[model samples]
Structures are given as structure tokens and as C-alpha cells.
Target: MIKENVNYKTLDLHQRDEWLHFVMKCETYDVFYLPQYVQMYEERGEGKAQLFVYERRAEEFVIYPFLKREIRGAAEGEVYYDITTSYGYGGPLYSLSRLKNDDDFVREFRAEFERYCKAEGIVSEFIRFHPYLETEAGLASYVNVTSVGELIYNDVTKTEEEIWSEVAPSKKRRIKKSKRNQVEVIFIDGKDIGPKEILIFYDIYTETMDKKQASSFYYFSLDFFQAYFTALKEYITLAFAMHEGRVISANLLLKSEGAVTIHLSASFKAYLHLCPNCNLRYECILWAKRNGYHIVDHGGGKEKDDSLYKYKQQFSNTQTNFHIGKKIHNQSIYNKLAKQKSKLVQGEQADFFPEYRQVLVTPRILSNK
Candidate 1:
């Protein structure tokens, strides 16, 4: 039980740590969607980008996991997770385990949020919001949930050896034989590398994007990578599969909370026939397991039962399918806009960037662990 009285001051590192620890125990602990990443994004922000925190005064100051966003609608402010680090709909990171005894906590938390929102002249908006609120704490006026879509994770722990052994023979053979193909998979600690490789990654990336009839959400300038390189480097693994001094495949993954997130993966078209893409991912799983990670997420497969669904199903130790849910804060406004916008997005077939529908390319990398 903590209480404080305060106004207007962003969380210093010391305060941020104490605040999160309090929230973590309150039954709404989600590592990925926490405010810390939002803070990270803010520290890295430039130009017009903004980051906001919901704070309350009590025994210990409380902060919520929302970041400041600039958007257009009825409102100028929205709560967001770090779009880059946030894989799926980050929503509000709340622990359902605290529902009953957290009455005082919730009342206090909401009071702080409302007071802050009012003080800052901010309004709530969600292009896609947390589905957990509906399942765990239910919903209210301050919270408006939306369906950005779902993200998937594979559970490998329950998978039996025979299931693994049954993978398509040709695929397995490719994995087995790729070892002789004169390729080097090197893991680099984030430092000691220049931006030369980032462009290489995009080149190999665009090749696959073309094959899939998709486009990119944002083509980052080298400067963008340079900007966050130091802070992000600590938590990320940059893996490249090289051949004859030429880089053929690469994966930009994040290792946090014992979880490895696959952010970007790509390989040259020349190597596709060799199944280097699959081999690269297989090696990732091995690294994940050996490092004591609980799961390696290959992520969502589109078309509900697309070809990828078949491919990743082979390695699934288990499947985590998030449900798509929504809550409209304003029903009339939503009903008016949903139809035309929905049609526009469905036309683009963009799965990764839910905010806009553009053709999306799903790249595959193959290699053995």
C-alpha cells in the first residue's frame, strides 16, 4: 500500500524501477508492454515524437504502461507501446492474478490516469488495443479496446521427438546438408559493427518482399539504426549467415525476459533453393533453447491456414493464438468509419503493419541448429 501526492515530472530511472515493481506484483505484469520500453522509445525520440506516462501520488508513485502518441481523430493523444519493440497489440499490461484484492490499487491507478489525462488535455485512442482488459478486468469509459489483430507464439516444450523427426524429409535433408554449404552464422554483440550490414539486410529483404507482392512499412535510413544502436544493442542479437565473404542471410532478433523476438529476417533469392531461410530459423531455435528461452516465436501465419502455417506447424511444441477483440469508446463514430476503412485495408493485404494495409512480405530463413 503506497500513496503520494505529486504533479508533473517524468519518471527518473530510480522512480521508474520502483513503479514497475509495484505494478508487476499488482497482477498486470507483462514485460513487453511495460512503460519502460515506452520510456526507451521516448529517450530515442526526435522531432515531433512524444512519450507520456500516467502517474499517481501515493506511498509509492504509480505509473501505467502507456506512451504518448500523435494521431488524428477526435483526440490528439493516445496510449501506445513502443511500436518497434512492440510485436503485437501491446495494449495495457495488466496482471489478471490480482483482480480481487487489487480494488484499492485499481481505484488509485484510474484516479491517477484520469487526473493526468485531464491535466495534459489528452484523449484516448487505440488503433488496436489490449485484449487482456476484456478478459481480465473487463472494460470502462477510460479504456477502449480494438482489434489490431492477433500474434502467435510456438510452444516447443511439449513437442515429442517423433513429431520433430517427422518433418518433411527433403526439408530435413536440406537442414542436414546445409552445413556443407560454406556458410557462416555469426552472432555479433551489438557494438563493433557499422551500418554497412543494415543495407545488406534490406536488399535481401526487398527481394523476398517482391516475391510476396508486398511493400515495406518504413524503410529506415542508416541514421535510424545509428540512433537507437547503443540502447538497443544491449538487448538484441544481430545474426548473419555468410558465404564466401558474402552475406546471404540475416536476422535481427531481441532477447528479453528470456524470450527471443524475431524482428527482421531475410536471405538472398539465390539461396532460397538451398532452403537457407529455414536453416537460419532452425539455428535460432537451437540458440533459444540452449540459452534457456522458453519459446521461439516464428510468429503469425496469414490466410488463417496459409502455407506458413503448415511450415511452422512442423516445429510447434505448442501454439499461442491470441483472440481478436474490440471495444468502441464511441459507437456512432466507429460504425461510420469501420466499413470504408475495413474495405481499404483488406484491399492491401498488409498483415504486419495493421495501421495501414500494404502488401506484406513474409520472409523465410532456413538452417540447422
Candidate 2:
């Protein structure tokens, strides 16, 4: 399906500002696709970040932010080069001026892109499609896209009471009870958050991860947060829930284009009885409404049906589908890895793509509870 003569290349770090400029003109772009977000991962030494640009004929171009990681496949002493979207949902952002509503252009670009991946011996490619952009349909021609789950978000245009009424009855009661219990929720402009507050947030975040028995990959170091918040200050908001002047829970939000995304949130287990987390989320919705944000995305759960999703459902009745796109370019190596991994997993039914990574997934981190 890909046409010849299409120019596709990976942009180096030097061209980062150009890439950022392109993303700025995109109507569907998100903060996750920003240059600062990519730099954070690169600084962490997570992988080699690449911005793949695909120019269709001489008309339009699309930018795909990718991470190139050398993963040890199932074969002994063998490494496979694979690419994945960033930790957050960041797929491809297209040029609005050149390719607006041009389905043919998107199809041609994807086809050419797949050809390039095959030529480079990419084992596989995985994408966490943007939740707010609604660009899944445009990507269907290139990858196997699936509806993973639904994200919960609030319609900020609704009146405070109207929005509150949509919350599950129990949630409304919890918010009321949290206030009666003297739990105070406040928002700190990102620029005002200092090192001390960042450290405190990291402690709560790490503890929550530990208690949940999460994989090591989910853990972020203090330096990462400091760099991230500092670089993205203009777009971030830090919310804290305090009980008698002690911070009990905190949430990080990224505001962009009239939408606020819940980036990170954690609550001390000891304060769970006080419903501080609920108050924090409720206040976030109100803050988004008051500050002119049109929507507040609470992200999604680990699975389609889970406690985390249910928890988010308490705040809003509106839901948005989250999609994931996965594809394999090197079939022979993929099969080899799958076969080797299948041998190691004797009894359980393994559903992980590339299969070699199935063993790395910690069983204890079963859900986003």
C-alpha cells in the first residue's frame, strides 16, 4: 500500500526545536508528545529517543515520537531492536495544514512507514494512542488497533452542582465526608513547587508503587520528577490534600489546550480512611472547571474492568475509549522469541506480544488498584 519516493527519516536531537514547532501547529497534539517529555526519558537513559518524520510525496508530513530500546530476546546472547511509544499515550501527530481530513495521505504515510520499519529490522512497534486526540481510526490501516478501555473525564462546562450530581452516590458522600473530616485540598502552581515538596511527592509515589508490588519500570527517581516539573512548569499543576496541615495525598496534572490530564496521583495508606484521595480528585474537577479547562482526564485503568476505572467512574459519567496499536515487522525473529518464551512458561497461558517479555511482567502487579 505504501508508495515509492516518500521520504522518511529520524530526526536527531539537534532538530528537536523544529519538531516542537511542528507539534505546536498540530490540533491533536498533547503534552506527552512535547520535546520536554521525550527529553525526560532520554535523560533517564531509558532508551534512545527518535522523532520519525514521514513526508508523503511533497505535500504533508507526520511526526512519530518513538523510543528505540535494545531488549534481550528469548534467544541466548541475542538482542532485538524494538520501538515503543513513550510511557504515556503519544502516537503520531499529523500536520493540520497539509493533511487535514486527508485519509488518503494518512494511509500512504503509514504504508511507507511500515516499509521503513521492515527495512530496518524492527522486531515490533507498539503505540499507546493519544486519548484526547481521537486519531485511532486514521491509524487502523497501519496497525492492529484495539479498544483497551475507557478513560473517565469531566465536562468542565457543566455547573459545579450539575457535575457533582453525576458522580456516583458513594463518591458524593465521600467528598462531603472528607470536607467534614477537615481534609483540605489545595493546588500549587508548578513553578511554586520546590525541591522539598517534590521529594515529599516522590516518597508517597514510591510507597504506593512498593505497596502495589509494581514492576521496577514504573518507578521514577527524584531527579526525573525535578527535571520534568521544572521543564514543564507552565503546563503543570500540583494538587495536595492536607489533613491538619500534613500532606496526605497529592496529584499531578498537565494542562494543555483547555484539557487537564491527571498525570500522577498517590495517597498515603494511613490516610486512606479519611478519604483524602477522593477529595483531591473532586477538587481537581472543580479547579479545572473554575480555571477554564474544558475537560479533566482521569486517565484509565490497568484493564477494561477494574477497581481503578471504577474509582475514576465515581467522578464523571462521561467516558472516552483508550486504544492501543501493536504491530510486528520481523516475523521470523518474533516467532523465535515466542517459541523460546513459550517453553519457559510451562503452564500458564501467555498473551504478551513478542512473548519474550511475558516473564518480565510481575504477576503481583495485577491491577491498577
What lDDT tens digits, residue by residue, belong to model 1 across residues 320-346? Answer: 444332222333333333343555432
Best by lDDT: 2
TM-score of each: 0.65, 0.89
Whole-model Cα lDDT per candidate? 0.50, 0.80
On a 0 to 100 scale, what is the lDDT of residue 290 in model 2? 93
lDDT of 2 by residue, 69-149 (tens): 776643566556778887888777777644735788787778777877876667878788887776565776667787878
